[model samples]
Target chain A: MKIHIYQIAITLISSLMIFKGFENYIKGKNGQTVLKLLVRIIVWGGMVLIALFPRFTNILASTIGMEGNINAIILTGFILVFLMIFKLLSAIERLEQSLSQVTRNETLKEIKKED
Target chain B: MTYFENSKIFIVIPAFNEETVIQGVIKEVQSAGYENIVVIDDGSSDNTQAKAAELIGKMAFRHKINRGKGGATKTGIEAAKLLGADIIVTIDGDGQHDPKDIAKIIAPILEKKCGVVLGTRLLNPKGMPLWKIFANHFGNFCTWFLFGLWVTDSQSGFRAYSKHAAELINTRADRYEYDSEVIREIHLHKLKFKEIPVAVRYTKYSMGKIHKQGFINGFKTLYKMIWGLIS
Candidate 1:
């Protein structure tokens, strides 16, 4: 099978979308945003690596980072999109956690009988 | 003529994450002589199923994930109808509705005064939050405007449906909007339903866990109701 640049680009985009969605789903389940910066740092580091050394495609593929010269560029784009989704999901998780916590505290306080 | 006698009147309580009140609601409802009461636990992470099971009822159901009140309701109705309930009475599992009022909601249908009965809390909205008051009024007015008929309360969840009415309004929304959608169906199908005065007891606990997004979701509900009306 010829490793066509376009096919590799499409696969990279699709894989990035799946990974990004999976991250959001996990964050959503945990209902927390404390790791958003950590996620951004990792994502940015990966982007920097790809931007600086575009020829490192084969090495990236072996390292499970990325594959193909054209695939690397598409993946870089995909990673940027995923980062935005990660931020959004993390923000939502934080909001949900705070709201649920407030509601929980209120419920506990309401349970106390007034003298 | 007595379906409750020959066949059981399965009271279907559609609950959504109701761990806090399911047990109490189940206990109250179980005290009544009606056999074959089925409770649909709509994907509650809490002890809704366990609490309901402890109430000594015949059967209990649960959804793997939250599908809203409409999903739970459809589950209950389908189960009861499939279980051969002569009549199915849908009441909230939120504990705001009085189990004692169950008889009143179902009586009119049994006696054939109306094909369906909706327990209108028009007189007892005192403890209800202000937003709900406004939303319900808006709903009532919209329903009246569209149907060109008078309905005291359009968003009351405490209601009764004959097997026939149940069969007619088989489709239901998968959200808190079921109440209004059902009313729209009742109007469109030309099915007769009576709005009777029933006392509603609202407490701080119950009020805390109600549909708080009143007017914010009012237009959405209006849209759904109208959609149901047109379709």
Candidate 2:
């Protein structure tokens, strides 16, 4: 029932992340789909809610058959790591495709010049 | 029964930032009596294209941007195919490769001894750097381990391929790894491969041009070979 400095800090950080994720979706910078955007917003929003209300995490932890209140934070941490790795892999795939395209285009240009 | 001298042979020199030495290499090849020459300038910022321009009859290709050595070599192969080449020989743009050695490497292909002729420098490693020799051995070992193909030098840039082999040994690697990829292709396609001892001139510039990741590149190439096979 006590709001601490760490809770306030976590809430602010998660809010910023949510705002940036939405901003990127709106600006079309990341080429995220509507579904993907909603998922990101919901995920970060859930983090913000959990940060603001620590007792809610205790309920989630117990429901998930986890022992301690800290287990919720551990679960969130694992989810964040998995999401980051997924994002990195997709980004690398995109980069590889673009690089191959660039190389093919350049090769075609040279061939055209020869003619 | 077709001799290389009578066939339509196309020499593809893949050059990247070799503006200083490309002209001399081309002239040397011309002097060796090889009429068909194509230079694929892999988007050099210098006057490599301009210097090659003086050769009126030969073709010079310039990539719009810097594609890697593999891309340039692929472009050169395409140009050769367009010219209806019977034999395609690829040589480095740097003067490290001897233009005269083209005949020696192509001789096997002409004699029907092999479809792919690799010009190896390890036999007479007189002027070759010690690091390069080690690198070549390491590359050969990786090629053996990955593809069960063994050669004296798997990383040699100077090679001759029959038109069929050249067309068949396609690769997607856009860097120095293409050298290793070619060996994998040769093996996968079940082409007859031969190795010939050839001399190489290792100038300070050419030596410096060797990818510093020669050792690491072997592993990368092996990974690519496996990925390519499965995917």
TM-score of 2: 0.70
Clashes of 2: 0
lDDT of 1 by residue, B89-150 (tens): 88888887888888888888888777888888875776676767777787789877775656
Model 2, runs deviating above 4 Å: A1-115, B56-58, B210-231
Q: In order, what lDDT does every prediction score?
A: 0.69, 0.81
lDDT of 2 by residue, B86-137 (tens): 9999998888888999989898888888899989999878898898798789
Q: What is the CAPRI rating of model 1's predicted complex?
A: incorrect
What C-alpha RMSD separates each model from the true structure?
Answer: 14.0, 6.9
Candidate 1 residue A60 C-alpha distance from true site, Å: 54
Worst 10 residues of 2 chain A by lDDT: A103-112
Q: What is the C-alpha local distance difference test score of candidate 2?
A: 0.81
Best by TM-score: 2
Task: List, for all models, the DockQ compared with the true complex.
Answer: 0.02, 0.18
